[model samples]
Target: MKTKPNVLPAHNDCPQTTTTGNSRRRKAHRGIEMLSAMGWWSYAIIIVVCVLGMLFGLYIFGRSGSEASNLTQLATATQRAARTQAGFGTANLNTVLYNAGQIPNGWTYSSGTIYNQWNGTVTVTGKTSYFTITDTGIPSSECISIAQTLAAGGVANYLTVGGTKITPASDIATINTACGNANSSVNSTTKTIVMYVGALQ
Candidate 1:
């Protein structure tokens, strides 16, 4: 009698092995899909954050621009009022400027008091030779920006940022330091800009 020859069984004969292999492949596919979904979510989140940052930056820029324009208008109006009165002469010029239609439009004016873009008090006071425009509740960045602009334009004889006087020679670094100091002071959230313009030439 001849011995039977040894041979391997067909793959279909092992059901358990086939099932295990299929299960492993399925699991790996599912894992790849999950990872792809997470990557897309992360990308979307980054886009949203960037868009929000841009919007916030735009809001700040617009606010600062409006404040600077309003301040410049007020200063010009004050000069006009002073010339009409022949001199500033220690008088409060708010009412005079408002009555003359000199105050900028959209400014909140009540009881001879005008409010700035930030709803802070804006006062116009006069000395013998020059008038002062004092605006409170300005943010530190805007304070520096407006001060530097006016100083460059040669409009203001002198100005103060948070009570720190800024001269023509004051550089950006100096202004930044002054604003930083003011913002860290008692009025931590806001600062003040006081601009002095000459009266009658």
Candidate 2:
């Protein structure tokens, strides 16, 4: 009776309260850690997407450059063949040129057919004083870019994008207009480019 002097039963609830508080704090900490992990994952995903986009862009740029180079090589070789070969104006100009080793490196030629970087058909047709180089399956934008560059450089006497003729003297506006016309086709996202380069003297 003397020991029970209103000691309040030793307050067993104090230990329970302390344990509950610690548990809540641990849950909050775990939540914070989970949020932090999610944020990191989001950032990682964004970085990966950006890297993939850049790589795709680079691939497109490199492919365009290669196409341009290939076209240039074909033009140069045609000019040289025109100057040296007596049969330059034949109906089978591509075969004749390829037989003479006029085809550019890396181009696939078999049975008189030439394939471009895009696996498109590349054909060479001849006239008396000029020859035509036609490449098919070009992307619309790349077709525009290549046509503009060749026109600006005065490399081709005349060229056609989607069958719209453009000359070396064609202004940027004119070229853009021609390309726009070709790009308006809903049936196809690709185009054909035909270049007419005069035979070298």
Off by over 4 Å in 2: 1-17, 85-87, 169-173, 180-187, 199-201
Best by TM-score: 2
TM-score of 2: 0.81
lDDT of 2 by residue, 1-201 (tens): 457556555666555535888899999999999999999999999999999999998887777777877888888887776544553564647887788788876678989899887788999887766778898988766666777777766668878887788887778787666656444765356778888888534
Candidate 1 local lDDT, residue 107: 80
The number of residue pairs in model 2 that clash at the backbone is 0
Q: Local error of candidate 1 at 63, Å? A: 1.3
Cα error, residue 111 of model 1, in Å, equals 0.6
lDDT of 1 by residue, 87-120 (tens): 7878788888888888886588899899887789
